[model samples]
Target: MGFIIKLLLTGAAAMLAAYVLPGVSIDGFLTALILALVLAVLNAIVRPILVFLTIPVTILTLGLFLLVINAVIILLADYLIAGFAVDGFIWALLFSLVLSVITAILDMIF
Candidate 1:
């Protein structure tokens, strides 16, 4: 299924992020898979509400508030998944950006 493939790509992206970014850490492939699944689920269920609630601020900030929204979600993923961690809010933000772009790229390529 496309959804499962996306999750796998996301897990791969997380692994790549851990290798590329000092601020991100993963215990192993299992943790990467768990983190990816948590992130995807949270993004599906919680992200919509958060986005709607922050719409005014997001609009006011000229859509830049999306960066903060992303950081929060990454932080959530870090908290929910054992053996996977982001160093701080800044790290979470950076990880989210890198992970998202990498996942998109990998999905397109493979």
Candidate 2:
């Protein structure tokens, strides 16, 4: 199914991103898959509420605040998932950005 394929791509991207960034680490592909699922759930449930609440700041920053929200989601994932860790906020931000890029490329290819 398309959803399963996307999840697999996200897991692959997470693995690649963790490999590329010293500050990010994943135990294995299984853990990467778990991470991908957790991220998707958080993005679906938590992200919209955060975005709505932060609209004023988001507008003031010209949408840059979304990056912070993304990092927060990553940090939350780090907290919720075992075998996955991000060193700090900066690392979370970088990891999120790298993961996005890798996922986009994978999506394009597949």
TM-score of each: 0.96, 0.99
Candidate 2 Cα deviation (angstroms), residue 38? 0.4
Model 1 residue runs over 4 Å out of place are none
> Which residue pairs clash within candidate 2?
none
Candidate 1 per-residue lDDT, tens place, 42-65, comes to 989989999999999999999999
lDDT of each prediction vs. the true structure? 0.90, 0.98
Task: Please give the lDDT score for candidate 2.
Answer: 0.98
Error of 1 at 66 (Å): 0.8
Best-fitting candidate, measured by lDDT? 2
Please give the clash total of every predicted structure, in order.
0, 0
